[model samples]
Target: MRTAAPYASDPSRVRGRLFAEDESAFRSPFQRDRDRIIHASAFRRLKHKTQVFVEHEGDSFRTRLTHTIEVAQVARTIAGVLGLNGELTEAVALAHDLGHTPFGHTGEDALEALMQPYGGFDHNAQALKIVTSLERHYAEWDGLNLTWECLEGIAKHNGPVTGALPFALAEYSARHDLELHTHASAEAQVAALSDDIAYNNHDLHDGLRAGLFSDDDICVLPIVGAAYEQVDRLYPGLEAKRRRHEALRRVFGVMVEDVIDTSRGLLEGLGSVEEVRGLGAPCVQFSPALWGDLKVIRKFLFTQMYRAPSVVEMRKQVTAVVEGLFPLYMERPDLLPTEWAKDVDAATTDIARARLVADYIAGMTDRFALAQAEVLL
Candidate 1:
């Protein structure tokens, strides 16, 4: 194991869970958190959730679960290199997308729009709900009862929360403050950046595989073209598959190395995790040059992949599915599973009922959602 950097999140000194339990004899607290996340029903549901492509669209396209695993792998790599807490990073990465609605951002957008009157839907906030209250597998607790460090990482991974907070997050923080006004620990920052790296790299690969764009087309982008040129120079007659993999791996390497080198310098003078949070900015990030290049690549992807004609059409279809389902559930809470009856009965206000309806709908998988639409809407 790498010796932790001075500023790394130290699991030994971690803030305890809301519902206290004896520390595991065999596992670090963060390791136990990672295990709990892996075993969560929300994690399994990720397999059938969509990103750019719907679940049944194709076998080769990335599902939410696969994308999450890739994020965890990248997070672990970056966290390991930075001497941060790898287990906590991996837990955050694995749990980051837990609240994403089925059918990718399309579904989330539709849900958000439909939910506008009821304090809006933010995936980050919903993820907080899932961990702190939604999942109910334990005999002693309703949720995973993760440590404050993991919860803080999840809540503030993107950065300091400001303005009006989402309802779910605000509701939780009312009971146990996540310190929403400050940056999360360095491990969480690594997890957040890893999310960016994973999506950008794999979105390109999936776009190519989906026939939305070609390797030739991507080579027109900044870092991609240089990578392709390097691959060609190294192996003049390399086959297309091998060549593409080599080039993209180079692209991936450039990002990882840039983040490590850039962050190492930023973390140089920090002496503790509190200093990491109080620095008033992220310590982990891509270099400015690489970030600019990534922006160009992201724009290309926005047009050629995420907003391609076929994808847009699918988006419309999924949007309708979410739109149709939310109102139906609101009109008919009895349609919610028997398991949800207690909460449904307890929810007295319109806002509470709307949020409850949204919760059930958000927890759905792509196929299950479509099936519900087919049957009810």
Candidate 2:
């Protein structure tokens, strides 16, 4: 591997895991963290979790697992160009969405609404919970016991948390301070932007495939229209599918190159990871012009795909599933799975029992949640 940049996260200087264990003989800490994430039960569940379309809706739509893989690919490329630790970036990207509920944002919104009287739900906080206190695999600890940098990156990758943190995040922060008010490592920032690149581009592709929008519609948009123009100039009368793929690939290239160029210019004088954290803003980002263009693209997507009639209908169905399940499990704790039933029974307060219910529901895959709803509700 290439030497990491001076401002990149250094494994040797790691803050160590929440529960100490012997280092691996063959793997670096970040690599081990990546492997642990890949092997986790939650990671495996992502295969059936929602990205946009419900997992059962179509075979071709991007599920959470595929989206995570795409994000990791983009993140590793950015990290390599910046001479940062690819493994750390990959770990953060891979583990970032492990906390998303059954149906995508729809399920999360429903759960958050139900839990509003409780501490409420945040996927980022739920992700931290999965890595820190859930995922009971190790005899020595509860969660994955990941390195502190990995945890910090996972918690603050979108930048510092200044306002009131969600319950799970506040609970973990009380135990180990993640320095919630500062930026994470540059690699984390790369992973965060990589997420942006993957979702924006892939959503456009998926939206087209789902027949929510058409090529003619997207061909008038800013970055996307330019890509189509370039593709037509190069390959006149190309097959429609091939033409779309080639054009979008160019769009993806533009985003990746913009991030590398923009971040390279930003990191010139940065000498240490601490300096990276203290910069008060992300060092890795698209150029101002590209960012503005991306906003236009996002607005287009919000209207054309995310809020399309078909998608909105599915969202309502899934929201009902989550909303229906939460109360059933809450009022009848015995309805929970065997292991979860034990926790529900032992809970001393309504909030404690509600949190346990959230954990059970949040861990469910789309089909499983639907099946449970069919039987229980």
Candidate 3:
């Protein structure tokens, strides 16, 4: 049977203010953003960046690039199953971490502290700034002219809509019911959850490979062990090279099936087309019972993997690199990309200066940021 759903319109095809081109045989707006981001210097740098551990440690472990790919795959799987826009979900998944700092969250934290007074250094907001006004690709403008839908996805990737919107957007609340304090589209929600599912499960696997933790340690964490047991039952000897890939794949397949089952039931309850599209139900999350299981899994990973003394030690080095770089760059903006000079001068105060510094740093990819830090040091 055909899906009783509207055809997913590409956000790129959505009319925008500044992207009106006369002679271009262009793609949709979201597609344009995806392609532009793929071509950008920053997106390419994800290859050298850390997802959990730094990239240079091992070839098998996930880098930012690989992690993004996994998230996109997981997200696309969920979106396609749920009749959401798979391409839009993939686009958001690809661009979701575009503004993550060099060493992942550690670098983001350092930059956030350094730029807190300057409207804060959030990865989501920086991503918005990058697509809207920061990154310099074309001589015509400072950044990529992404569509509002893509911008909205980036801004609200993992946060509450109330907190995610810019101060100005706070006023235009009603026109965007989706923009207001409401649930994100099923696509964005799927991407967000996929990010959590991908990182939490994979990070544990990586931690074990690094010898920072062991499977026994992970299995000790309440229901997480059970989940692993399920994996074992589904694909035993997952530690074996051949089974490891299959094991992970089964986990994703299982989780995605859960999401689809839940979402379809929820969608059935919506009475009309307007309600279905305009007011996204909050039923997109993992069901509470399943989430309870996931929580136990997350807690075990957090204590045994993320906060392990060994990981902290490595993160300290990353923190130092970002912290060291922020001050030096702020003190001498000339070190940044040439585009920042005008923004710096237009700044009326130190707050403005700090914001400009953030613009410079946030635009950097993992490798470029590290290289620049080394040059400054």
Candidate 4:
């Protein structure tokens, strides 16, 4: 591996895990964290979790797991170019979406609405809960017991946290503060930007594949238009599939290169990871020009894809699933799986039970929730 930047998160001086354990003989803490996340049941469930489209909508549509892999790929590339710790960046990227509910953001919105009175639901916070408490496969610990830096990245890779914290995050922070008010490491920052890059690029590809928009429609857009023009000039008669792939691949490259160049300048002289965080702003960013273009792209997607009629209809359907399931479990805690009975019985308050129910629902996959809704609701 390349020498990490001075501002990079150094696993050598990691803040350590919540529970005490011996260090690994073979892997860095960040690598260990990444492996744990990959091996996690939550991570596997991402395969059936929704991205923009429901998981069952199409075989080729990007699911949460595939989207996460793309984000990690972009993150590793950016972190490597910037001399950040690639493993930590990739780890953060891989774990970033672990908290998303089934059926994409729609499911989250539904559950969030139901959970509003119970301190509300946030995928980021739910991800923290998953890593910190939900996955109970360990012999000595309930969750993965990841290192502090890994948990910090998972908690707030987007930037600092302020205002009201999500209930799970607030609860965890009470025991072990995640320093919700400050920025995360430069590597974590890279992971955040990588998510933007992956989704922006892939959503366009997925949208086109789903026939929500056309190549001509996007050919008039900024960066993508230029890419198509470039492709046309070089491979004038390229097949549609190849052309789309080639153009999007270039679009992806542009975003990646922009981040590396922009952040390299921003982080050039930073002497430590603390400096990166205390810098009080994100160092990893797209150029203003690209960011503006992405907004246009995102706007186009919001109208032409995300809010497309078919997607909207599916969203409504999934929303009902989450909505129905939350109350059912709350009103009939006996409906939960046998394993959850112990926790359900232990939940002494309405708020506690509500949050517990949210945890159970949030961990569901698209099909499982649908199946459960069919049988129970």
Candidate 5:
């Protein structure tokens, strides 16, 4: 790894973990944080979780695990170019989607609606819950007991939390004071934007593969259209699959390069990591032109892919599964697994029991959730 920039997060200057331990002799703190995240149960569950498609929907679609890896790749590249802590960026990227529910955003949306009276669902906040209080593998602690910086990055990855927070986030922030009002470190910001680049580009690929749209459909869009045009100029006789791959790779590259160039221009006078955080805006971002173009592409995707009839049908099915399971589990906490049953039994209030029910449902894999719905509903 190259030396980090002055504005980069320094593991040596860490705010320390919630439960302190002796520093590792070989690995940096951020590297250890990355390793812990990789070994986490929630991280492993991502393999069976959804990005845009459910896990059982197709073999080729990107799961939360694959999407996180893609985001990490983009984040590390941008972080390396900008002289930020690549390991920290990679760690944040890897852990960013850990709290996602079973059926992608659809499951989350359904759960959020059901929990509206109980403070609602937010995956970012759920991620904080997973890292801080849910993962119980550690002998010394319930959660991963990650470094303060890692927690901060994860909490503020989407920028500041100025308004009222979700229940999970508010509870955790009350305990650890993640400084939710300030922007995260540049590394976290890199991880956040890398998520955008990965999902936007990969969704295009997945949508094309799923027959949600076509080359003709995307070729009329902004950034994607330009990428296809470039690929045609370079490889005129390319086959459809290769042509799609080639064009999309160029789209990914353009987005990555835009962030690097734009961020470099933005970081000209920033001298310290604190300065970067205090700016109250991201230091890692695409240029205004590309950002505008990406918004157009995103709008196109929302209309043609996300809201398509086939996808909406699947979403409705999965949403039914989620909504059914939450109330069933809440009504019969004995249906919960042994470990979760203990938590449910200890709950003294309706809201507490509801949260436990949410946690159980939130942690389920897609197949598991569907199976549970069938048996219990």
Candidate 6:
């Protein structure tokens, strides 16, 4: 089905014209955003990045690429059901994690520390940089100069009003001064919520596979476990894949329904719907109700998955590896990859040096980082 009229404006500022190359074909603005993201180089790098474990650890676990694809799937379904822009949702979902470092959160933490003085490391903002100014593949420009909508989706991929500080900044003073942050557009808000849904639901599945947690342990969670039980009762003796898929679908259906029902009220009542429409483009977000749900889920993930002992243990090693490498690389700039040498010498201060260090580290995959650390060790 054709996507709804874009909830946001075309980035090009051309009124009444589609973002597509030719409007005669009737392509939607969000579709154009999705296509551009798919063709970008950053999207492909996800395959090598960690989701839970290193990608090569096992065939069953989700890699960053798989996780991204799954988020897109869930986001698209939610968008379609809610009369939102599926294309824009898909675009945001696909690109949301592109700036994530190679080893997943571990890499992010390391970069955050290393870049602490420069500005700080924020994966979402970095993803924006990748598409807009960092990716070298676009010879004609510094970056893709994607639509404001796409940029918003990526920036707020965690959804609007996260009540969280900006993940990073361009300079340390911005952070130290506790500066007020600008909000990301609504489209990014949807992507952010979708990301939460994808990880919370799917990580349970991945956690089971990695021996980090058991299905029985997972089943104890509030609604999710109950949802799993309902699926088992409904489909007795079904094939494993069938059962798991059915279970996932059921859970997703619940979450999506909750988001739609919740968001519609906020959009209609809280004035965001009219508010966003007035912005001149297509974007979507968590209704007030969904935002409440987000807090609940965040608590659960923190208590259950994120703080799990296994994950914590692995984090230590990751912190050590990345932290150890930073000073070494900085002291002997010669240790950096050839591409970074120019940036190294040109850097006028420690923050710039840290960013260069992070650039080198962020570009590495899980194994490459380990390998490099070993050489330094």
Model 4 per-residue lDDT tens digits across residues 44-157: 999999899988889999999999999999899888888889888888899999999989999999989998888899999999999999999999999999989989999996
- How much is the lDDT of residue 127 in candidate 5? 91
Clashes of each: 0, 0, 5, 0, 0, 11
Off by over 4 Å in 4: none
Off by over 4 Å in 1: none
Q: State the weakest 10-residue window (summed lDDT) of model 1.
A: 336-345
Q: Candidate 2 — which residues are off by over 4 angstroms? A: none
Candidate 1: tens digits of C-alpha lDDT, residues 216-245: 899999999999999999999999999999
Residue pairs with colliding backbones in model 1 are none
Q: Write the per-residue lDDT of candidate 6 for residues 1-377, one digit (tens) a residue.
A: 65443343333342321122443256665676678788877777777788867666687888888899988887777766655666666888899888888778877887787776667888876776677656676445555645556665576554432344533423322322211233444455566777878887777677666766555665665556767788889888878767767776676677777776765554443333336634443244444555565566567666666777877877788778888887888888888767687789789988767777776777677777888888986
Candidate 5 per-residue C-alpha lDDT over 1-377 given as tens digits, one digit per residue, 9 for 90 to 100: 57778999888999998898998999999999999999999998898888888888899999999999999999999999999999899999999998889999999999999999888989998998998899998788889888888898898878999889889999987778888898898999999999999999999999999999999999988888888999999999999999999999999999999999999988878989899989977888889999999999999999999999999999999998988888888888788989899889899998899988888788888888988888888
Ranking by lDDT: 2, 1, 4, 5, 3, 6
Q: Candidate 6: global Cα-lDDT? A: 0.67
lDDT of each: 0.92, 0.93, 0.68, 0.91, 0.90, 0.67
lDDT for 351 in candidate 1 is 94
RMSD of each: 0.9, 0.8, 3.7, 0.9, 0.9, 5.0
lDDT of 1 at 208: 91
TM-score of 3: 0.85
Task: Estimate, for each residue in 275-314, the C-alpha lDDT of model 2 and write its tens digit.
Answer: 9999988899899999999999999999999999999999
Report the C-alpha lDDT of model 3 over 24-102, residue by residue, as the tens digit.
3766555666777788666787788787776665788888889998898888877777767776677778888877777
Off by over 4 Å in 5: none
